[model samples]
Target: MIILMGIRDDEQVQRLISLDSKSSLADVVTICRSYEAAKCATSAIRAPPDQLRAVSAYKKGKKNKGHEKNLSTKPSPTTATFCKCCAKQHEPIACPATQSICTSCGRQGHWARTVQCPANQAQCLFCGHVGHYDKCCKTKKKDGRQSGSSGNSSAPNNNKHQDTRINSCRHLGSAAPTATKTPQPLNVLVSYGEATFHLLMLPDTGADVTVIGKRHLEILGIPQSSLQPPACTTTLTADGSTMAPALGIFKATLNLGKRSCPARILVHEGVQTPLLSYGHYKAIWL
Candidate 1:
């Protein structure tokens, strides 16, 4: 009861209450750490503009205390606008660091620390092209028909359920899609162990498990051989076809805006795009 009362957060309290006889103190500590880590990783504490300016002014005054410097004649730091890009006082958009190269993706137009890199600006996982992600890649099909709306459009659908190992092709259709409406990819920033990725994922309510491609694992700097086997041995796809036996599975924290959810991600070979499961969507958004 004291532990329950101490937890001010409704979510934290609810999680603790849900545990049964199997739960231990370690579970409680893990829950607390997850919330604390999420809060620290996602939030930025900053002083108000006025308070920041006042501190700047105080520092400037202290630096020229002995000298006869005309403090009033100079433009006051308290009234100046702070520029995050170049760490100078100037207009927000008029940053001199705009011309500098971004260390994140090696782009030359923006500062990586101050701005979010555009998804289209990154390399596409499927086509090995720039200006788009694998989710938006339109690769040609084997039957001279365009692989329309198929998640793994780059790879040709051969084998035809004959392979011994499980293979999951979520939307491998032979016909071209006639619908003009396109599915918007969900942009998520995910962090695993220590690596972080700016990903464009497809929100799949159909998939029971969140899936990440082998290429994505490589990009995250995680080796394919290092992951653990999934709880389920055989996996089935949306089309009722057996999914290729998973390469492995790993737990990662997915961040969307200010919300974060821990998800068990399955790694599969030949998958181009990442699939965000419905359960994870509810955990983060609802």
Candidate 2:
């Protein structure tokens, strides 16, 4: 009978880390490759971020700054505009606003507002309100019109109430923005075309698709033109947010515990780890 394994919880990860006190998360994954763990090494991918340490000389520090910087706790991109060239999060960098450059606003000689070359001004995506753009949508602006007959005896109090209501409107309209995720690194051996090497993977049940970093593609010796864009998909993170429009997907083999099989992965930047999800866990023969 075939069996499936889900991601390991905190207890399981802690126990596993405690067992091989000396093994780092990556090393432990290798150990699992040797041992007979039926689940993807990604299951034990979490180990308090401490398992991600060097064997030579361990030290204490802050969170995954590399990832934190890219996928930091900062607010998510409010703008849906993506780069026409790279399809990254924002639009400024892709086509910098300079002489004759687009500002993602579709104006010539200024910053382009459109994504494509023949910049076209589109309607507001949010609120469906025409004129204003999505990022600057003000549909839900609070109706702060004060309730007064213009002859109230309490002049000072009425003014104060009006100001308070105005402030409240602004506050309500600006809700807390979604934050980004900082995945910990999980090192593993990835085999492709008979060549194998250790790579720091970020096993995230949160990540919808398992993606290889675009920068790491050079290590695999695959040209960008060789791979096509991945099918449209959505990724949900532990932070209760979704990652959309990953660069592309690729086929690879994950070697874990006497088990190696063809697996599909996604390719992205910012995070160092290769995303592995619970769905990927089912590939393992438990």
For all candidates, what are the clash counts?
A: 7, 16
Question: Per-prediction TM-score, please?
Answer: 0.37, 0.32
Over 201-241, each residue of candidate 2 has an lDDT whose tens digit, in order, gives 65443334567677788787877666667776566554446
RMSD of model 1 against the true structure: 33.0
On the 0 to 100 scale, the lDDT of residue 213 in model 2 is: 77
For model 2, how big is the CA root-mean-square deviation? 36.5
List where candidate 1 sits over 4 angstroms from the true fold. 1-183
lDDT of 1 by residue, 44-116 (tens): 3454678778888999888888355665567755665766555577766677878886554455665554434
Runs with alpha carbons beyond 4 Å of true place in candidate 2: 1-186, 281-286
